[model samples]
Target: MTELAVMGPKESEFVDRMGLYYERLGGTRTMGRMYAWLMICDPPHQSLTELAGELGVSKTAISTVARQLESGGMIERVPAPGRQHHYRIVSGGWAQVLQVRLVEVRNLVETLDLGLAVLDDSLPEQRARLEETRDFFAFSNLDGMELLKRWEEHRKNQD
Candidate 1:
């Protein structure tokens, strides 16, 4: 295994900010830090041991978060020479994440549609609220899909 470079103060601060951002988005700080580090880490890939050492966490913790990230399509496991696992960010990882979110948005739209169906006609205000929320999500879902398509095209062009 190669020696991992020590993180400088600025890099560490950026990792911490990413951690907080991920935490706010319902993910662990460790996961966010690891993700941030991976984005800029040397050689573009790191093993569990390397990640644990860099983040001051246990290998088990890193492994757990790695699995979550892999399943979520943000990162992917790569084959290395030894038994230790390695991971790196995917090319369209953010787009994959957005795709997952759009699915959730679609689900919410369906739920709102159900709510509108069961809602009483007498409650005009409640119906209006549901209608507005549903409309917003529906439009957002459409826009998000278009955005993802455009992003993919742009990425392909870059490549």
Candidate 2:
């Protein structure tokens, strides 16, 4: 298997494109660039200066991206005694990110449930539509919860 540090041409192209896609999804281009760099860079935790140099960006840009990642729980800030703060991808980061997104999913499910209840007092035609919506969201919530449980188990195993 190829080492993580060495991205083949195809992988490099994919990573670059993914960075752009993430940018379109409300993340800054620099944040996406930093994530791509972290995925392929050697030694995991890169200094801001190193990432800035590698990505051909300024240190301030790298610093901002690092803070964004840190707050989003995608990366951790490591401050060793007398050393500058360094950033590393969080262990089981994807699972945690998914968990956070699931909160929104749960809220959606709850909103649907409320709609279903409101429709129960309406005409039969409206009730059918609302019930259908409720069923879908209920099933979705159960599935999301199952996936979350699995992720928790997987994270525990990794620990």
Candidate 3:
């Protein structure tokens, strides 16, 4: 009776769609379903056994996925009353995810810089293209970090 007992068709459909979206993000389909479910689950926190039953996945699957999500700063693990661990979505701006994005953008800029350094100066056309790429990545990293800062400010204002 503590469990959902039965998930509605619409809910299942939503989870399925979320799973697909997560798959596009380089994660397993079931992990996506688990995330979507956690976002809307009535009680907001659930034990591994509960999640396993709700997700129709093995406990090991839940553990693996939850650990991965946890490492990514997406989900959090907490202590349950029954000595088991509970899982829930980490609230707020997802600064860690944004940090990862910024790092990727920085790497892109670095790669572009390296290309500019190694490319032949005689090939004006190639040099120009690399310069353009370098400029774009540099701008992208700056813009992305600025946007993240604005987001933090917005969230702070809301608080």
Candidate 4:
């Protein structure tokens, strides 16, 4: 009969939407669940067993998502010596993570650009919409990169 930190209704909804977003962007549902658990759980760090239990996923899925998050710079694995490894979400300036996702969106825009071109002006309206979307992504990507660079510089100067 113990209570742990849990997401409220709004946060739960947010996590659910984020899970769908990640799934749509080619990540597995388990990966999304892992992220959700990390965001809501107290301490922000968990072991494979804990994550698996919370996410109701197999240990293998937890391991895979942990590796993926680490590689994507969204999380980092902690060394625990003779114990199982633990992971924590990347802290400080969530902006960097946003920038990474924007880059991925920018890549999608490039692919969409190709598809629209192949459509060959047959659907001018659709082409215009796609072009606008592409332009927005390109601009956002550039802005994100610049912001992250400035943040890095500021952090260095603080030292």
Q: TM-score of each candidate?
A: 0.95, 0.74, 0.89, 0.59
Best by the lDDT measure = 1
Backbone collision count in every prediction?
0, 0, 0, 0
Ranked candidates (lDDT, high to low):
1, 3, 4, 2
**How many clashing residue pairs, candidate 3?**
0
Which clashing pairs does model 2 show? Answer: none
* Selected candidate, larger TM-score, 2 vs 3: 3
**Candidate 4 overall lDDT versus native:** 0.78
- Model 3 off-target regions past 4 Å? 1-6
Which portions of model 2 miss their true places by more than 4 Å?
1-14, 80-83, 152-159
The lDDT of each candidate is 0.95, 0.76, 0.86, 0.78
Report the Cα RMSD per candidate: 1.2, 4.5, 2.0, 5.8
Tens digit of lDDT per residue, candidate 4, span 7-62?
Answer: 66776677677778789978877777678778778867788987877666799989
Against the true structure, candidate 1 reaches a TM-score of 0.95
Q: How would you encode candidate 1's per-residue C-alpha lDDT over 17-61 as one tens digit per residue? A: 999999999999999999999998997889999999999999999
> What is the C-alpha lDDT profile of model 3 across 96-126, one tens digit per residue?
8878888998998898889888988899999
The lDDT of model 3 is 0.86
Candidate achieving the largest TM-score = 1
Pairs in clash, predicted candidate 4: none
lDDT of 4 at 68: 90
Candidate 2 lDDT by residue in tens digits, 54-91: 67789998888898888888888777444566677876
